[model samples]
Target: MMTIERLREEINKIDEEILSLLNSRASCARQIGELKQKNSLVTYHPAREKEIYRQLLATNHGPLSYDTICAIYTEIISACRGIESPLKIAYLGPEATFTHMAARRKFGSSVEFVPVASIADVFAEVEKKRADYGVVPIENSTEGVITHTLDMFIESNLTICAEILLEISQCLLSNSSLEEIRLVYSHSHAFAQVRGWLKSNLPTTKCIEVSSTAEASRRAAMEQDSAAVGSELAAQVYHLNIMAKGIEDRVDNYTRFLIIGHSMVGRSENDKTSIMFSVKDRVGALHSMLSPFNKHNVNLTKIESRPSKDTIWEYIFFIDMNGHIEDDNVKEAIDELRESCLYLKVLGSYPVAG
Candidate 1:
């Protein structure tokens, strides 16, 4: 039988081997980066990242969970990518918000994160080349869509390079005890999600609406007898105690965020395409616009409508479809779709979030 001392020695040897391999990988990444820069190619590739994850996960027969392996590789990949090219990512701001969390999850901690005040600012950062990419919330499972984010896409020329699905776990953070808490601060959407829990736990506490959960945490940290409903990260950033955790009323709450950049992502094994269009002024035009996808056997994952803002009562339709724009079925479907629409735009084709 192996002794404890021997097992530790073996583990240390394996750790050294890992360190050596990581350094080799970093060297290779730097070479690739140089080639990409010489060729004028983008540093980040969503399809390649997805391919790496897929290949690793497929071969994994592990003592650790898939999530654990992915988390470990995420940091390693981030570090290697940083050695190649240091990236600056813009996100909806005052860090510790859900958008910030989503941005971190997508790009990892190696990148510089710039937190802007609004979704439009995130777009501006990327559009002006101040940031390499931008992350913004596009929709929520419980709250439908972020109309402002959708609206920004109509005017901005940025493409959706990737999507991130973040499970939202709201927490109550404060310096005071539950009994001593007299006020609560949170975003309006957050308050709506945890309404039932707050009603039962702190009925008399007045809930003040703020721009974001991080801001709420900041306010709670400064004010006496006040608590904030936010993320665990916010609690750490603001130095507040987690008075209550998993406080959201629903268990399945999730928010989807989009990574916007100038570079268009190439097709992956599993790809999704997003498009925006406006139907012509004719009865059955909207219905006719969707018929092509069914006719071409193309799958549409989601469809949403927002006011054209160009014309009153005229709506612009956004659709998320199942394949890359390069695919035959998708190409055919869009070709047919344009006949019924006054305007159409292919936002991007990217790897679907796992």
Candidate 2:
């Protein structure tokens, strides 16, 4: 028997209470920030943030889905964290790129986002303290690893603080109709992803390669009868209509981004550790390097090899494994791994991206 008028009145009352609670939370956050500053601690903690999300999601039995709860809390946390200290994050781009999106996903919208020209620029920003952290694409499901990113780690002192896993959905953005489109601008990777779609749909349209999807959208906006293969966010940022969406050859395409910073992240319940090493130049050296992991019952999630730029034909092996470096099993395995390798470096141990 509740009338719409009565329900709206109740909603207004709840909103007022919600505002009050938010202010209280912000006040608490401010106090914590003061303490952190005094003690010389970093503002962001991956494990702490993950614990908050896990607790909220575990208790949620809702009229709203878990995704909805996460979305709401992300903004709320962003606002609260901004009250503490505004973080400056650098990403590869002119804005609206997947790396930008991934940076936003981890830090939220309240922080400052600096879009740079390239992945190396992103690293340089954080290294020089121009930005608090940098987000760069490490690998893509369709195109494989980004070798440049791995190479940067070989010489940089930065640590992997966190990671972001984002699903890539290519969209065709244009000012004109699909039939009127003459040129398509996008990154080489995007072109590779949507090759099949472009072949079938716009076989004759001239495709131009640009630095990024955001740049492509910008070019599409300026040129007549032009389109760009990019993200829906690019469409929004560059003020273009989405002519088509989900145009990638593979529907399951995803990209993994790494958050690099000066501070090391503490361990979480579910964690991943990344390491790089060069095996000794001898028979069965590679096998000897991997045996310790099996002996310690540690699970390796991924392994990739890159040329050691210093020496010809020599390679460095990068690996991702489950568990924190502080864990006894992982620690022991790494000790064993070091014995079989010419050199070993522990990149970081961070909470696995959800």
Candidate 3:
């Protein structure tokens, strides 16, 4: 049998090798970053990162699980990218908010997180070249799409470079016991998500809506008889105790966040393109326009409509399809789609959320 000391020695050798390899990787990344800056190219390449993740996961034969390996490499990539300069990620935040969490999850700890006031501000920051990228909530599993985020895309001149799917787990945080909790604070969305649970558990607790979960946590931390419904991170940030965890009514609450940037992302191994179009006013016009997708054998994952803020009674159709914009079939389908439409816009083509 192998001795413990021998096994440790082997591990130490591997550790030294990993350290050397990481520094070498970071040096290469720095060179790439310099080239990118010289040529005015985008440093945060989502497609390249996605491809790396795909390759690593495919070859990962582990004592560690798939998620563990992914997480490890994500940080490794983040660190390498930071060697040039830490990417500034603007997110909707007060801090400890879900969007902030998603941004951190995607970019890892090596980057900087700038908290913005609203979704519009997130777009403005990226558009003005202030933030390297902006993350905004696109949709939620339980509550459906965020209209404000969809609305911002209408005129924002930004592109979706990546997508983040964050599993939202709400916690009941308080300084006092459940019975002692008289007032509950959280964002309106959180309150809505856990309304059923709240009604059953703390029927008389005064529920107040706050700007963000971080703000709610602050209030909870200050108040003697208050509780907050948010993440465990929020609890930690504000020094509140987690009274209960996973308190949302639905077990599978999830929020999808979009990474927005000035430039378009290149195609990844598996890609999804988002597009929006306004149809001409005619009977059967909408039906005829959609046929091309089916005829071209393009698979549309989602279709949503928002009132065209430009014209009254008119609507814009936002579509998510299972291919890149550079694909021949995708191009053909869009060309066919444009023939009957008043206006068409490609939002972005990016790697589908893992």
Candidate ordering by TM-score (highest first): 1, 2, 3
Task: Give the alpha-carbon lDDT of every model.
Answer: 0.94, 0.93, 0.91
Model 1 earns a TM-score of 0.99
Residues 1-354 of candidate 3 have per-residue lDDT tens digits of 999999999999999999999899999999998998898888788889888888888898988998998889889989988987778999998899999999988999999889998999999988998998999999988889999998889888899998999999999999999989999999999998999999999999999999988899999999999999999889888999999889899998999999998888888889999999999777887788899999999999988999998889899989999999999999999998988799998999999989
Candidate 2 ranges beyond 4 A from true positions: none
TM-score of 2: 0.98
Please give the range of 10 consecutive residues that has the lowest summed lDDT in model 2: 279-288
Candidate 3 lDDT score relative to the true structure: 0.91
Question: Can you give the TM-score per candidate against the true fold?
Answer: 0.99, 0.98, 0.96
**Candidate 1 global Cα RMSD:** 0.8
lDDT of 1 by residue, 1-354 (tens): 999999999999999999999999999999999999999999999999999999999999989888998889888889999988999999998999999999888888999999999999999999999999999999888888999999999999999999999999999999999999999999998998999999999999999999999999999999999999999999999999998889998999999999999988898999999999998667887888999999999999999999898888789999999999999999999998887688999999999998
Off by over 4 Å in 3: 1-6
Question: Which ten residues in a row are the worst by lDDT in model 3?
Answer: 280-289
Q: Residues 1-354, candidate 2, lDDT per residue (tens digit)? A: 999999999999999999999999999999999999999999999999999999998999998998888878888888888888999999998989989888887888999999999989999999999999999999999999999999999989899999999999999999999899999999999999999999999999999999999999999999989999999889999899998889999999999999999977898899999999997567787887899999999999999998888888788999999999999999999999897688899999999998
